[model samples]
Target: MKTTAIGYSENLPAAHPEALLSREVPVPEPGPRDLLVEVEAVSVNPVDVKLRAGAPADGFRVLGFDAAGTVRAVGAEATLFAPGDEVFYAGSIGRPGTNQRLHLVDERIVGRKPTALSFADAAALPLTAITAWEALFDRLRLEEDSAGTLLVIGATGGVGSVMLQLAEALLPDVAVIATASDDARAARMRELGAEHVVNHREDLVAQVLEIAPEGVDRLFTAHSEGQIERYAEIVRPFGHVVAIDDGPRDVSPLKGRSISWHWELMFTRPLLETPDMIEQHRLLDAVADLVDRGRIRSTAATVLGPISPAALREAHELVERGRTVGKVVVHGWEEAIDSARESTDIY
Candidate 1:
C-alpha cells in the first residue's frame, strides 16, 4: 500500500487569490467506526474558498466537502463499510478531508454510492445533498414524507440544486418554487423539478404571489444573508424557513409571521461529536437509494481534471464568482485505483 497521499495545501491567508499549493503527505489511518476511502472524485464548496482565503495561521487546512470513492479499509468497530464498497459522503468538517488521495471518514456519515451515476456525478451530491436533506427534513422538522410548496432561495447553487431534486423525490406532488436571478439559472431550477421559477433580484413577495397566491408553506435559503427579512414577509403564518448560510443580523423579522426559522450546518453533528452523528449516514444511504431508484438525479454539472492545487484553486474561484450553476467535480487519484485493485483481488 502507498505510504502517502496527494492533496492541496494552504499555508497562509491570501490577501489576494493566490495562496494554495499541492503536495504529498502521509496517508491517514482509520479510527474506530471510520473508513479509509480511496477518493475517486471530489467537489468544492463556498466554505472551502472562504477558509482558504482567510485561513488561520497553522500547519495547513485541507478543504473539500463532497466525494465519491471506494473503501480501502475499515476500523475495527466499523460495521457498514468493508474493503471494497463504492461509497459517497460529505465527511466531517472536524478532520482532514477528501482533497487528498486517501481520507479517513466516520462510517456512520458515509453511504453506498448510487449505481446509476459516475464518480464525478456522485461526488457532487454528498455535501450539497446532505445540507439540503438536513435543512428540509431535520431542521425544518417537516414530516418524514409530506407534501407542500417549498420555496428555494438560491436554486442555482450546489446546495439549492440538489435540494430541489430531493424535495421533488420525497414529495412528488408538492409544488417547488425556486428563486434564480436570471433566465439561465431559472431554466436550471426547472430542470431540477422546480415548478415555479421566481427572480430573487425583484420583489420575492410579488413574484411568489403570482404563482401560489396564498403563500409558501416551507422556505429554504441556500445563499448567504440579506434575504431573511424578505423570506419572513412571504412565508405563510407559522410556515418554516431553514437557512444554511450565516449572518450576524437580528432574526426578529420572523416574529411577525410567527414563522419558524432554522439554521442548518451539515457539519454540526460531526463537528460537535454529537450522539446522533450516524443520522448523516442514514440520510446519505437514503439519498443513494433514491438515486439508484431513479427518483433523484445527480446535480454534478461539470467535471474538472485531476485534483491539484491549481485545479482546486480554480474550483474555489468558480464558487467565489457566483456564476456556477451546479456542482463541479475532480477525479483521478491513487487511492481510488488501489481500492479497485484490492476489490478485484478479493473477488
Candidate 2:
C-alpha cells in the first residue's frame, strides 16, 4: 500500500512555489516500540522551513515536526498505545516526518491528544509546548515559587505564545516580561499572560531595565537575531538564559557577567535515543491534562485547510514570513477514508 505525502525535491527557497510537491510512497511498517499513526493534522514550524531550504537534491526530504493522529497499528513492545488511540507528538528528526498519511513514531515520544481540542489545534501544541516546558523547568530550573523577573524575547511567535502561558501557569511568583516589536504584538503578549511587554525594536536592555531595574533572573529567547550581547547586559549576574533558535549567535559576552547559557531542542531525547526519552511522553501528557483543565488553551491561531502539499506550502510561507502571532495548523488528509476502522479513534 502507498501513502500520500508532501515533500521537497530540491533545496529551493520558499518563494519558489514548486519547492513542495505531493507524492505517493510505500507505507512503512512499525518496528518494535513504534506506533504507526494515521496522521490527521500537522503544524508547520521554523524547522520545516530550514529543512526545506536545505533539502537534499537526490530525493524528496519529508519535513515536518508537529503532528496529531490516530494509531493504526502498534509494534509488539509498544505498551503505551494500542490500535485506534488518539495521539499527538513531535516526531524525531532522524525519521521521516509527519507530512504524510501514515507515520511511524516511537510510542515513548507520543502523548494522548488533549480532549479539549480539535486535531488541528492539538497539532500546534506538541513541538512548541515541549520546547517551552523543557526550556523553563529543565534548562532554567525555574520553580513555582521562584521569585524575580523573567524576560521572554520574541513574545508573540509560536514558541513564545506557549512559553508565556506556561510561565504564568507554572511560575506564579515570577514576573513575566516579554519583548515584542509593535503595539499589537505587545498587546497579544499581554493577553497570553505577560505582565510587561517591552518593544524589542528599541533598546531591549533599556526597555527591560525600566521595568526590572535590577535585571531579570531568567531569560528565554525563542527568536534572537544575534542578541546574546543584549541578553548578557540585561540579565543579572549568575542568571540563566535558554535559547531555542537555530540561528548563529555569540555567547562570549555572557562570560563576563557569570551568566549561564543553555540551549533547548525538543528533538534531543528522541534523536539521541536517551534513556529518559519517555520524559517527553510524560510532559506531553501533563500538558494535555492542563489543556483539559482549562489552565492552558491551544495556541493555534491559523488553520490552513487539509494536509496537502499546496496547503502545507502556504502554511510554510506564513511561518517563513516571521510575523505569525501563534501556531499555524493543517488538518485532515487529502484522501478520504473508506473504512470505519481508520475513522473510529477520537479523543
lDDT per model vs. reference: 0.80, 0.88
**How many Å off is the CA of 121 in candidate 2?**
0.5
Model 1, 1-347: lDDT tens digits are 44333333444343324466655677777788889988889988888777776656256567777889999999989999889999999888778768877889999889999999998999989988889888887887766467778898878888888888887777776789998888987887888889999988888789997786767888888664766667776788889888878863777888988988788999998888799999999999999999999888877767786676666766776777877777777777545557788999999
Predicted model with the maximum lDDT: 2
**TM-scores, all models, native as reference:** 0.90, 0.94
Residue pairs clashing, model 1: none
**Model 2 TM-score on a 0 to 1 scale:** 0.94
Weakest 10 consecutive residues, lDDT, candidate 2? 333-342
lDDT of 1: 0.80
Q: In model 2, what are the clashing residue pairs, if there are any?
A: none
Question: How well does candidate 2 match the true structure, expressed as C-alpha RMSD?
Answer: 3.3
Error of 2 at 217 (Å): 0.4
- Model 1: lDDT of residue 304: 81
lDDT at position 82, candidate 2: 95
